[model samples]
Target: MLKGQPRATSPRPAISPAPGASEVFQLLRDGQPRTRAELAQLTGLARSSVASRVDTLMGLGLVAPYGGAASTGGRPPSLFALNPGARAVVAADIGATHARAILADLSGRELAEERQALTIGDGPDAVLGWLAGTVGTLLARGGLPASELAAIGIGLPGPVEHRTGRPINPPIMPGWDRFDVPARVQESYDVPVLVDNDVNIMALGERSFHWPGTTELMFVKVATGIGAGIISGGSLQRGAQGTAGDLGHVRVAYGGEVVCRCGNTGCLEALAGGPALVAALNERTGGTLTSSQDVIELVRSGDAGAVQVIRQAGRDIGDVLAACVNLINPSVIVIGGSLAQAGEHLLAGIREVVYQRSLPLATEHLRIVPSVAGDRAGVTGAAVLAIDHVLSPESIEAACAALTTG
Candidate 1:
């Protein structure tokens, strides 16, 4: 079954007095057909209540009745399952250098996707305007009308206050401090707007789509900047202020020699980030290489200088992650982002340091691997965010109630 969105406020959502449509809907999330009696038995609700919930869900197009199950005697009971095409959401993954968007159905299937090179430095107005326009384009391409848009989920390359969908003071994102991103996009699309730090959403995407079984996981993004998406207890950790995984600014041994975009000196990002590696490469080879993609290509082509630099960056990241193993003790560490694509050198450095430095008990079953979701990590995760919100028991109850009233 697809994982629901994590709630930071509570370990789990509160249960209602009786099983609601959300509970009945969850019974069919696995695409299995079940009779009202089966759902009633599972949820401990009366068959009539289960029937009512199913009817409400069917009216909302989230549930559909199909066929029937075998019966011991008399007539077979009808079965109901979740409808994948019931609703749609627009998912956007915005980075410092590029932007991507996708239109996805209730089942998290991408109906349409588009990508373009853009800079977050262009500021919020330009970026959000383009995002709003992209959402419309995706809806049209996917043949979904505006009425079917349930919500919009976005991942921004910055620290975001999840409740308000506003960016905090982000180093790489200029003119986006405390900017109301949801409001800007909501002007174009009236549906709910959800925003989160890009890497956090990527973690959600990676886990929901690929590693749903892993209870404890961490998604480490090594790109133009550095960050980690920590999953403990099968839920995303947002910390006290929602910046728990901000690993880039951790102080390192450089000792104020290097400055970061956040105006800090001796940050890990300044030491091992993409720009740092690029600068180190240019200084050594006297070649002007731009972006994390350039460093990746150089390393792929067997440039020893680029290889050595990326490896050390991995070690630098591992140095911090080693402490993470001791504290959080995750079962898996997934390396992703542009720099992680530089081949085994980066992974080798990380493994070498992580295993060597971490506790024996912690490293015994720890698995450090590269990301499988690739570029789809952000958008898929964005979709997961929207999907979790729109299909949640509370949201479904409200929607179903509205349908019944109408």
Candidate 2:
């Protein structure tokens, strides 16, 4: 489990900095209830101060009483926790061929979600309009009004200028270049919008929620395209151009005469991505496979040609990741995306090559595993982005002050 914030001083017998409503809310965010005395003791604030902050938070609808704790002696004190239904967050994960939307509360508990087919080639206007309509429907389904949403987050399939939520020269998305995505979305909902690469959000979701203990991690997605999400020291690495871990376009030393979608030749994606694997299998088996899903089904049903190419793709991917492991030395490497569903054939090939080529120390503690959340990782990570943005110290302070006045 994620650890709590370090105490300003020790929890036992020490005078510390005064705790504010944010501090009190953080304490309650652990999903456990604490009485005024317990909170005061933990935060090193006076019982009176604790009460004042708690009352303010209660009025903001972020915290609520959950019944009384066990009484040691005197009267049993009322316990308080975060109200799971106070506000909702809207998160969307837009991929090349599909999109997922989720409605979650302040605590990251998902309320409702919808997944549907969406083509990125349809342009941002059509996609954003569809997203707005879907969000309205989902909010209605969850019995939430539009005013209850605190923020919106989106993960796109291409490189994004994170500050403005705009796609910057995305290769796959034809009409999204330099598009003001956040501005367009805010026109519909009038809320803070966050945008990032789809793989970056997947890495965030994996690290923030699933592997909290992993400070150094990498999430590699090998679907229609190949890319990586790097988390160093528990934060996403977007690099100078917000395209840090773009493993897809990495040029292969041995690849020759293969053209990539980016108009580059001999790129890694052309050599080992899902489309490449499918093309190789189709040529080998003389069968028509339209999508990566077909390749996955073939691998699942024990097709020799599909299995061989997937393993080769894994090794091809591992060759690139071996260099990454030596450079970053991530403690964990989570394999996700469409091809990951092929199971151990792909993982085994990656592990075989990565451990063999990477430094002994790097490979010793490195865990190469498949993604646990699977398809949900993108949406879950988007929710994390929104929740963190809303609960940030600056935002929290402003919100608390506004609540006190309102």
Candidate 3:
């Protein structure tokens, strides 16, 4: 089990300054910009101790005093915030149909972003070359030097071998297996590179931004394919080969003739994925539905046929998720991807079956909600990964030394 936040601080504790200083820095990173006195109150340290730590951080150019507080019959307190330009990161999200790149500051605010339709199946070299060019363009446009970039992070549509930083035998992504994506990206930029599955990155984004207090969370994306990201016990569950949450290939209906890209039959993806749903709808209505957007518009217009198709697809998806819930018992289930735009019709079907089939204790207080991040989740998650990787203890110390000496 994962531990929760530490207990609240009491006034005037004799806390050591070294650990308190790092904690104070983390608090600021967590979006709590406070004065010395406010930080002292939160860290159970004296005002003088907080001031000493703040002085050291300011000397290192990592923290900056923004402005003074309103006077309350006393000296105004100086507010402090992290220096946004102290370091930067490059984030990339490589999906089946498209790829996006962004240059983000230390504060995780995007400085520049670019997206283009990706013909991923062409080969690994072509795809990587495209990503490198786009990243260079983004950096140049943002007027940021390559030296200022601390690290690069990529989220790919396939399973990643975390230790080796290579994609595995991913079904949908052709010619990506055995590719050393991180090493290749690092050669171009001369910075640390991190890579993971897109769903894992999305899960990180949700845990960091959307639901801060929760530890057990699940993000289900029903897009061109159906997949999930599992965050249990405050740690990502990257199974033996870092392919734990590849739910797209889960066999929902066995012995069916429909073939999946994975060379499997009757997988959940073949039943309720974006392509599957659109094909089903087109077959029934005898109309041409080119994309998931077409299905969303028809469903929104109260087309009974469209509604029925989506509802059934949702139920099919929910059945698999119900099994997942019974096993993982996550606190929240976030639904994302293009099909999620179907709204209540889809959610209702999922909720109905999940509650009916899952154990009472597992889902008694579970909340199923739509993702707030939407299409940007993958890119933002990639950015967060890069930021966190660069901000690790050893990396931070090295970066600080490099910047200070230079």
Candidate 4:
């Protein structure tokens, strides 16, 4: 081995490419296998400048020539595209009762995924440790190493400080407030990490996958708790203190005595959330209902009491959402989470209430649709976040070089 090592190879010093390389890579990423002239046209750069940037990107292995364009009375031009297999990303969604991990390619397609039921209320340490292990398992199952990851995106069940990337007194996730979730995950995987509220990430996924161009969108999640992710003008509206979409704490009844996790009485979540609806139904029908799944089954079986409970919850949720519509004037409202499984019964009430309460203009063109992502929305949303960050020009170049062998 020592003799084989003695065979000297040239010590090639790594050279950082010019700044324009990133812009060039972005253009190529946008247009796969685009001709140099086409790239120049798209980027508004001179031919010579585009050529130099392309050469730099090619040297970095972030992009490669695939084929040549058809000649139009001139010499054929070479085309280039991103090296899709050059890097990977990890995404995790940490919910109140479960956590999911996925390994995805640069294009956001999941290569491997894993899920486990883990109580997040025990503390941040236990939940985060489980998350890290799940991520590692996903990477190993996908045949990718930690070094190949470009970044990790995390979705947690709480309001996240976008600037500090920390949870902020989230009601369901006890002891998670102010914890540096991104840094903690990064410590385990040795990669860049990004964290955001779960519903916000779900909104991102919806925008990236389903509604591409429409701007004003609201994603309401009615699960064990209620929250909304507001996207206005193609940007997430976190507002001051990162609690813009904490609709769970919004008062539904003025002086009622139903206390919420936030210590508030008559909050919207205290009325419409899964446990509340189930408790109400159990009290009415004299039957035990454990989870949202049970409630949905009962409603599907045409149980009058269950159907009525869900419908009433829907009305209450819609009343709150009507206020949101009037305030935000969102063009589309997406209802998601376990409660959304009620389908027409829930949406009908919500639609009916919104039309009845909100201003005509606000409700005129507003479309209330159920989520298509279903239970996978959180995982998919987390994956979208990672892909958006990792596939950026700068990140692509950096990741390519980091994963490349000279």
Task: Give lDDT tens digits, candidate 4, residues 81-174.
Answer: 7755557888888888888888987667788988889888988889888888887888889998888887888899888997778988877788
Candidate 3 per-residue C-alpha lDDT over 198-220 given as tens digits, one digit per residue, 9 for 90 to 100: 98899888777788788999999
Candidate 2 lDDT tens digits, 1-406: 1122111211222122233678877787766777899899998999899988887767666667776679889988887877767778999999988999999987788889899898999999999998888889889989999999999989999999898889999888999999999888888898899999999999989887789789999999998889999999878899988989999999887779799988899899998888888788889878898888899999999988888888988888898999999999999999999899999999999998999999999998899999998988999999999988987767767777675455
Model 1, runs deviating above 4 Å? 1-19, 253-256
TM-scores for every predicted model:
0.91, 0.90, 0.84, 0.89
Q: Stretches of candidate 2 above 4 Å error?
A: 1-19
Q: Give the winner by TM-score: 1 or 2.
A: 1
Candidates' lDDT values, in order?
Answer: 0.86, 0.86, 0.81, 0.81
Off by over 4 Å in 4: 1-16, 253-255, 393-406
**RMSD (Å) of each candidate, 1 decimal:** 5.8, 5.4, 6.4, 6.2
> Which stretches of candidate 3 lie above 4 Å from their native place?
1-24, 35-56, 69-79, 253-259, 282-291, 398-406
Candidate 2: residue 211 lDDT (0-100): 94
Cα error, residue 52 of model 4, in Å, equals: 1.9
Better of 1 and 3 by lDDT: 1
Q: Rank order by TM-score, top first?
A: 1, 2, 4, 3
- The TM-score leader among the candidates is 1
